[model samples]
Target chain A: MEYPAFLPAGDCALSVEFGDAIHPEINARIRALREALERKPIRGVREYVPTFRSLLVLYEPCVLGFDRLVKKLQARMAGLRGVAEGKRRVYVIPVCYNGEDLDFVAAHARITREEVVRLHCAPDYLIYMLGFLPGFAYLGGLDAKLHTPRLQNPRTKIPAGAVGIGGEQTGIYPLDSPGGWRLIGRTPVRPYDASRAQPILYAAGDFIRFAPIAMVEYADLERRQAAGETIWEVREA
Target chain B: MSSGVDRTLRIQSPGMLTTAQDAGRVGWMASGFSRSGAMDLPSLRRANLLVGNDKDMAALEMTMTGVACIFGCDCVFSLTGADMCAALNGQPIPRYTALQARAGDTLACGGARVGMRGYLAVAGGFDLPAVLGSCSTGLKFGLGGFAGRKLRAGDALPLRCPEIPVSRLSERVLPVPNALDAHWRAQRPGMQLRVVLGPQAAHFTAAGVEAFLSSWYVVTPASDRMGMKLEGKKIEAVCGYDVISDGVAPGSVQVPASGQPIVMMADCQTTGGYAKIATVAGVALPLLAQAKPGDKICFAAIDVREAQRLARREAAQLRRMEIW
Candidate 1:
């Protein structure tokens, strides 16, 4: 399905909203639009940020006015009518089911905690967007059984590496910040680092799977991460 | 026009909060880049004019209080905005005036008494690395200006002293605006900002739109470059469309779920989903920058053409005022 072009964001940028609702197909188109822009950048184009259901393209007004830029973007969209291919990457992230909300989540879903883990690890999730905070990925395809609401009162500080679930979406808190999601486990990798060449570890179109591990192994992995050793058997799946 | 590198300004004491800033980072909002730069562009411009520098030159943005420093060599510099009481080895120096500081002499600025921010501009521009087209410091994303962070007490500042014809600020050299400047230059009374109706203006009810322009809103303590959260009548829409995320710009006023209007300033995020009621014009940005907490403000409606006219007129006046 094609999307409608939006008006200027301000004086310098424009937007193209794929759809009003959150759907997998719409998100895939959003990714496709990003790739299209990446492949053939506009003259005055500075950056293109892809969101869950839309894409924002910022440009220099001096080089290309709002009207001219919009026309250029529209032409690009029309050129890619039928061939919308979103690039995808698959990653395996190990986790331990033992958590403060593990038992509570099991009771809420009317299933065992182990069963909850089984359902969660079943499907490969796709990253729809990267927002709210830097390196915080908004992953889709969460297990229906594990779908849960946010906390009544957000915690003052959710530690970095926390793997959390909110509704049908699951995410990892790349940095220590105030959050209200239910944390099931954590990953030791630095999902975000400003000093690094690539600040964000994962981008949109990447696939992710959470692998279950024993509690002792979690502690051992933490030690390994602290010692600057690779924790996960992180290989491209 | 091309000269050699001049003496580097050695830092003696980094003040409370100081960072290198140029005009601002633009053209990267779609990439989630914030427009992080000097909060007060007018003050920076005035200071730059005093030193005969371009409007886009990099300067030090000091907040509230400032640090003590010793110039490595004699150089012409100007200080503007706020009564910080800058001094040379405890001797008082005039504000909004350029002065030559000799080497081995210490310069310091006291705390702000009226305003929250200040600008200190050297004869030439400050030597700093430009990141993604600007040297503006954005600490949140950690990009641009002094390693993308605040200047510490021990940090050193480099200088590029261009040997151009010296220009002093007097009646002859000072920027003389035209009739428009003479009329509008009278510092606007109070904090009310003139705005053009937003793209989402249609979403608001007639009463909600009326309340938005008629009522007075207070600038809260939580206000910063990211946005100004106004406290006033809670505006409710006739219907809410969980707006699809779209690009946003500086000066866009977004009315979120809480009904409070958040006026985005420089350093705001690239895009948001809130229903924006209006957008402050770029020409009026200087006035918005001077706003302080507890300041009561109102909104006045304007058309897009009027906004563009105001911006163009301001640019023309600015060009006529400066040598560049």
Candidate 2:
């Protein structure tokens, strides 16, 4: 693979662009560079924000100049071997397909509610990156049949753990906030819990599979989650 | 008040949107958190310095309107940023100067006369617990700073009381003009912000880039802590406005499909899908923060090296003020 172009984001930050579009290989390369930087930490590197096709790095100008920082990154990239593919964690999240917009999504897709649930559960969606809101994972690999447009008028508040789809992507809302996605199901497990050692549950390379559950099971899982019990079953992907 | 325990401030009223802010929350962007801090960072640092607090110490960030609070114990405090016509016991207090307050004394602040946000820093900084390595409030995520929300009436904020006598230090320290205050005053009538042409500068037409540099953009009422939306000449794009979502930094000038620019601020989202035409230089962020609705701002494109030089110069100036 060709080395990514290092573009100046601003005086304080720089972007290492992997490609123009989002692809699994491009994302893996981005994550590889991030992991490399983490292992051999660069001086004055403050933040590393990984996206679909690039990694935005913020640094203090006082400690490290932009040119020098880019040189260090380039040197690291030269030593990086084939994409560092670690064992990706697959989380089994329990979801109840009884969302307020489930019927709307079914009608829009020209399928029954049962079909909607099946299509959603079939794929182990890849976690692209986390953004928009805290713990909100941008998942790719949604079934082409489930591709639906966002709401014309977004709802004011989407509850936490609400599974929704917008365009080619489907994600879980980690917090109650105004969103434009079409909600088709609700998950019992919290994607974000501040009290946890690691606040966010999943990383960029992880995979998530939705396990359809009944209303009774959803209520039981919700109760267990509130009591600080692990709800999602995790295993090596 | 107890003799040895920490001092505190009882909020009588929180005007507009008052939240505890510091330098910023760093190293958390990967977890989808923005570095939410004071919009006018220079002012916050100056206010903290005046009260002999750490430069990045937590302070009250008052927006549009100021706050009204009563001192639970004796302390020295300073007000900086927007001159909100602050008063101590009905008598007006001067901006950028530290004043001693006794227990039960009320500090009332009125609406800003010039800038949008104001800073109130106490002697030893607020005793707020740092969440995720920062006390700066991230209101969207509802984390950090005084219960991770805006300061409301009846909220009591604990202060780190000085072990030594602060009275002597307060008297010895004279009010001096800080470099930040001087730089802010120097750019009075002309609101020109220096920006660096972007990582996606080629996405716009030459005419669009020219329009952005030459035309004036008015600050719209839709502006807030998240971003400042501007209404001005349309910046036509050559290859449309959408981009694969990417990580956004503060002061990014993102132009959407509508052609209008939105300057991201302190509490902006971690990632955005709009194409960024330019990024406002770090040194000019304070100036942009002070701009209110209807204010007209012109952009001047500077090279990345020049932006770094300006940032370094500002840092040097701030360091020089330590001796004064």
Candidate 3:
């Protein structure tokens, strides 16, 4: 277990970074800290935000100013390395393999389109972090054979739930946003819905599997979701 | 004071681009939420002060004016910012001075003759259910304000007055100077934005980093609450480098592929992959908030201690305003 230095992110916030390189263990610790903070919020703590390898904690300036908060955080961090044990949840996200860049990715991977789908679904990828957009989970453990670069020119607007790969990671767009990731498929599930008790269905450290579905099935899922339906199937991992 | 939803103000005209704003949203930046709220912090504070409302009280933020409202009940209110040529029931009213309007009087605010934005504050503050503990409108994320959207015609806003009127403040409060005030001379416009060099600051070439500190940047016309598109030194690493997606905050300076440094503002998304060079000190955020499009700004580097002191002093000044 390793811990990097803690530093100020900006005024009113401090970032405790774990490591420079993206590692599964480091990410797990990050998730653990996030969980612990949420489960037991500090008195003056306003926010505890997680990144790839760091946790940015924001507190109210009036109640617990930066200096005092830093001391409290330092004491808290001294013993927070071992409380990450948990039961992880695995979700099966159905994706329609009809993205605009699916063909280009298959060509780059030197495989047929069918094989790309198979490899993508074979591994149970872990959610490393939740960032960029709401419900947009950054999943690790992509198949090396499926590694691809982001598009040279990003699309002006990638449809919501468009699943794509960039470098060694893959994620779903929670909203209709401009992106540059290499697109491969799109899911029908609303990655983020404000009305739900838990707006984000997935969190860091959870595992996810992308099961490719037919275009017709995608259309049906979209319809059911629009009518306020639960689109994902959850299984304990 | 009704236990029910309280008296509601019906919109006769929704002003040009009125939106509800309070202190911004928090804790959801990693979820791609922007802390969208009032653009001018000091003025917003003043407006809240005049009404004896909490500093985080929600107010109607009018952009460039044309908003007309009707009081639902007898209430006390105050207006701040550019002379909107406001009137109460066809009688020309004064800006920056608290006014008492009876129920059914139409309060109209016209276009700006000076500044860009104006704030309207009720005695108790606008009544609205806070999303994430804020009534600030972030139209891009559809998070807060009235349904997380801009105010439109016929949108009836709820009014909730405090139990007592502002007995402390005199009825007349002078208009806040559109320019920096004499009180702020000690905090003089540093023109230079203090920054704590970011983790990605090392990614750029030494020369590039030096240029960033040395050069002057201007806030472009394209700037808004989301971010400021700056025109200055085209800063880059030895080559365009790819950085892992990371969390961002307001006042972060990011150099995208275009090589121009874009300073993220109040409405900026929480996370981004761009190589962030620096984060401007939060004490200077209010000054940045007051910047108009095409305003000239320069970056000056200061240590974190100085930034904290500056923030403390400014906050103390704000607290002192309560006495008057």
Candidate 4:
């Protein structure tokens, strides 16, 4: 509801709110703040977790006080420029719309399965944040027609690479976890690999677009991934 | 904690939930990795220091129950936190003290004697690779720890063997009194954790906030390292329960539509969409971590500055004890 409200997440952290809703402008502002902090490291701030509309800044209580840290952050915000207005990285992920809930989503939306798949792969979804699981990107900007409620009875274990929709959100499960999201498809490429030097595939403030593939193509991509090939493509524009 | 190993700990019977943990995995929260680490950090440090290892070295974090492990080499070890009635080779060993375990010695650890979790630290620390910069187990994503899972039977943990035998070197005893220490004594009359209400305090009605502070809650059976579900007075919300998804820290008390509060723990997700009412102070985490299921809990509102002061005091106390 408000912009720039410094609230205590705990004694050691502060959640700096930019706005109440998930909007591109608010997310851009958070990304700007994060970039500024990274460029010029804060004295006591350890890490910054940028979410839909807030930046959770974690610091050591023994090193700095809450009020003093807020004051320092205020000064930084006052002089902040449009850093996030520049180039936004994009991730092209391939998915096969052969998930178990494909027919269910189509029936609920009162559209054909092809139409549902078309709507799902239409937009370049904005990765608002990564949470719940490691490298599990929380993407925004799903088609209104495909906005379906989660399963009444959540599934016990949704496998990794399953593209899912829950409420007004959509994302990919990087790991197998018990979740309530409606799965529409599955991706062979992993958003997260613990053994990788980078570990995570993408970051917050990036754009993710789904590329539809046939069942045979999915098998090919899966085989490539298994053979140590980078399936996902990253384009900087 | 240092590289190079000479000994190994072979698990004969894996307890209820036992895993290796260190301080935690940091600098990766933005990527959605949970800060999974030792629940009772103070006890972890004490146990590690007692065994002549670095304070934050990877140690066995036994929850509720203990493991039946066998030493593959002669080494020194120590146990802390909730006593699990541990015995080396059929002889009972004391908590918070270093002991000598001969090669092939069978160390059996029973259920918790007091608190809900315990820590076992060996002399040279376990020779586990640091996944994502920490040895802590991230159970959610199945990363870190021994093959990214809890301790199970047939898992042999490679560890560094102590260079000197017990007969050659001086005995390693902690400087602090081994009696029911100050920390445990203060938490005897049930758990009363301090809270700093905010971040989403505006989302809740004043009466709802009042109910939360004035009520006593019970930890439900459905609880784990991720979060503790507390059932008590229903904390009402204003319009709706859902908030725009945001980052959540450990100890965040998130209240959903059901009016129940789920206090995030050491292994909770990095972000959550539920509206958080308050966060328990860092100083109270050790006590909260030790709280067992069915334990009564009360909340006391404390200013953020005061909570920070208490945290500083605890850190100072630990540092003072570390000198010995």
Candidate 5:
């Protein structure tokens, strides 16, 4: 693969563009660069934000100038190696497919509600990135048959743990806020908990699989989660 | 440091949008957290210096209006950023200078006369719990600051009192004239913010880029800490506006389908799908922070190297003040 183009984001940050389009290969390269920077930390490098096809590197200009940082980043890229596939963790999140927009989604896809649930749960979605909101995971690999457009008018408030599909993408809202995605279900697991040792439950390269549950089980899991129990089951992918 | 004395400040009236902030929450963008810090960082550092506190010490960042609080112990403090017409015990106090306040003294401030935000730094900084390695408040996540929210009436904030007397040191050390001089320039209207063409500059038409540089954009009333919405000539996009959601840096000038540009600020999200036309230089970010609604702004394009030089010069000047 050719070296990514380095573009100046601002005086304090630089964006290394791997590709113009979103692909798993490009995302893997981004994750590789992030891991390299982490293992061999660079001076003045304040933060690393990885997106679908690029990595935004923010640094302190006082300690490292833009030109010098660019040279260093280029050298690092030259020696970049592909990340070896490790034991990836797949989190099984329990969800009750009884959201307000379930019927709307069913009609839009020209499929029954049961078909929508099967299509949604069949694939282990890849976590592309986390953004838009805190703990909000932007996941990929949604079934093309279940692709639904976002709402024309966004709701005033979408409760946290609302699993929704927007176009070809699908995600879970970790916090309650106004959103426009088509809600299909609600998860009992809280992806974002400030009281937890680690606030966010998922990372960029993790996989998530949804498990359908009954309303009674959903209520019981909610009670268990509120009582400080880990409800999501994790296993090596 | 002894933890004997319990010094505190009772909030009599919490102004518009007051929150506890330090330098910022760093190294957490990967976890989906924005660096929520003082919008006007230079002023925050200067205010901390005036109060003989560390440059990154947590202080109260007050918005357009200022907060009113009563001190439970004698302490020295300095007000910076905007001129809020602050008074202590009903007597007017000057800005950019450290002043002593007696126990039970009530400090009040009125609407801003100059900039958009103000900083109030106590002697030893506010003694607030750190969340994710910062005292700065993340309003979106409700993670840090005083209960992860803005200050309100009847709230008492604990203060870390210094061992040595701060009032005595105030007489020996005076306010840095260079720092104050730069702040004066920031208060002036019609700021020309320098920016650099972006990673996606090719996405826009040549005329669109020209219109962006030539037009004077007025800050919209919808502006907030997230971003500064600007109203100006429509910068027509040759390509579509949507892009694969990517990382957004602070000071990024993103042009959505609406044709209007929005300058991302400190509280902006980690990733955005809009195409970026330009990004404001780091040295000029403080100027954008001070700009209030209805303020006029113009843009000038500079290369990445020039932007880095300007940033270095600003840092050198701040260092000359002996604050950091």
Candidate 6:
């Protein structure tokens, strides 16, 4: 861990990097600063992405000069310590652990299928940042015991809502994107529905808890969700 | 009274990669959405301005070529960016000037001979619904533009025109001291890009940074709207090229394990894990956009203050010359 650094992304944007590593404290610091900016507001700042360890802030160059903007950001960040995260909610994702690679992951980890499920559903994973596809929540807190390597050859198209694990990371694909992640399960809920007013359901810093569901229940939930019914609710964490 | 025309541009033959685009889809990068839009943004603005539409009005962005279209109505239009070898019904037409096209008049925009990507803007702008506050096509997610994808043959793009005034139909062209044109011409052969050393510049060794600045990288064929892969010197990074995935801004020059730089473009994914050495200045992005694959490009380190200053200067100049 180093001193909070203001690294320049470009002329119009800057990355207020908390650290080079991805730690919960580093991420929390980045999120707190973003939350403060979102509430009180900065005039020139257009948008901000609170990622794993940095807050990449895009601003209008004409409105606020680069040097001045950095000074302003520095002043705001000075008081961010112990500042609580604005709002945190855990979205309970229903996953049917019957994916093609579920057994493979269990075998690789030298664990039973039931043990794998228990480990996967145990921790409340933190949404590090959304990337690759829209509403694709990159989760943290994956149990080390279930850590499995990605497939040797990437799949052409992993189905949307396909819960997969690659290396140490576990995330659900919001779109049918080509990925190397080992598919362990499937979820019925759509994290991203463009038809909805807010295209994405959850933002970075939100928590995600995967709840195991049976195949029959999964089929029924999938059908209901397809028909625009809300299957899962956000639990205040 | 209005029996002579209709408000639509019927596509006879879609170009290589024709799609509707605006300035960009702003305010959604945090949601993992790329600012998918016209590659040569200034050209899009200029075309829109010539046709008397707002600077960011949606227009057809024909990449590496121009689209073949038939005017459904008598409308004022303007073509800008790369010399698309455009012709009006078998006759070569002029770009950067407001031109009148009659109903049923055909426009054939051929392959680019100058730069890559052409913009065709009609008066009153395109009649397309904006998704996520923009008409720019985000093809990766199948969102926005012509049903969220590139144009195909027989696609009828409607126009929002309430008849152009007869008095306003005079031949108006963009006046001299064209900065965008000058900028494009300046970056021709050498095609040097100015960059601000990065959020992850420390990830690379000092010699690596020096090598990156010195080497002349050629744009690879795999380059597209997503990113431009460059190959030249293998500038090694300290430890490894992997970073704990972070926000990647447009023009973020990322170096993966291979040690080659990949300049993220207009439609690049919002975030990446590769260690970024530098970020190309936004002011120089349009120049880079016009670069063809195999074009030799190099980088120059510029300070953030100077970078923002140049951007502001260009924007202010464009604003002044916009209505003139």
Clashing pairs in 1: B15-B67
Instruction: Report chain B TM per candidate.
Output: 0.86, 0.94, 0.84, 0.92, 0.93, 0.94
lDDT of 3: 0.76
Per-residue lDDT tens digits for candidate 4, residues A54-128, read: 999999999999999999999989988745844778888999998888888899999999998899989999888
Candidate 5 lDDT by residue in tens digits, B33-124: 99889888988988887777887888999998999999988888889888899999999988888888878899999998877889999888
Task: Please list all clashing residue pairs in model 2, or write none if there are none.
Answer: none
**Winner by DockQ between candidate 5 and candidate 4:** 4
| Candidate with the greatest TM-score versus the true structure | 6
Chain A TM-score values for every predicted structure, listed in order: 0.90, 0.95, 0.90, 0.94, 0.94, 0.96
Task: Evaluate every candidate with DockQ and list the scores.
Answer: 0.22, 0.76, 0.46, 0.83, 0.80, 0.81
Model 6 gets an lDDT of 0.87
lDDT, residue B166, model 3: 43
The candidate with the higher lDDT, 3 or 6, is 6
Query: Measured with DockQ on alpha carbons, how good is candidate 4?
Result: 0.83
DockQ of 6: 0.81
Report the lDDT tens digits of candidate 2 across residue range B1-324. Answer: 457543789999999999999999998888788899999998888888777777899999999999999998889998988889999999998888878998889999999886888999998889999988899999987899999999999999999875446765464233433334454467654488999899788889999999999999999999999999999999999989999999999989999999999999999998999999999989888888888898788899998888888888878877865653
User: Which runs of model 2 end up more than 4 angstroms from their true locations?
Assistant: A1-3, A107-112, B1-6, B171-189, B321-324
RMSD of 4: 3.0
* Tens digits of lDDT, candidate 5, A154-181: 9999999999999988989999999999
Clash count of each predicted structure: 1, 0, 3, 0, 0, 0
List runs of model 5 lying over 4 Å from the truth.
Answer: A1-3, A83-86, B1-6, B172-189
lDDT of 5 at A55: 90
Candidate 5 lDDT at A95 equals 91
True contacts kept of each: 0.16, 0.68, 0.33, 0.85, 0.83, 0.83
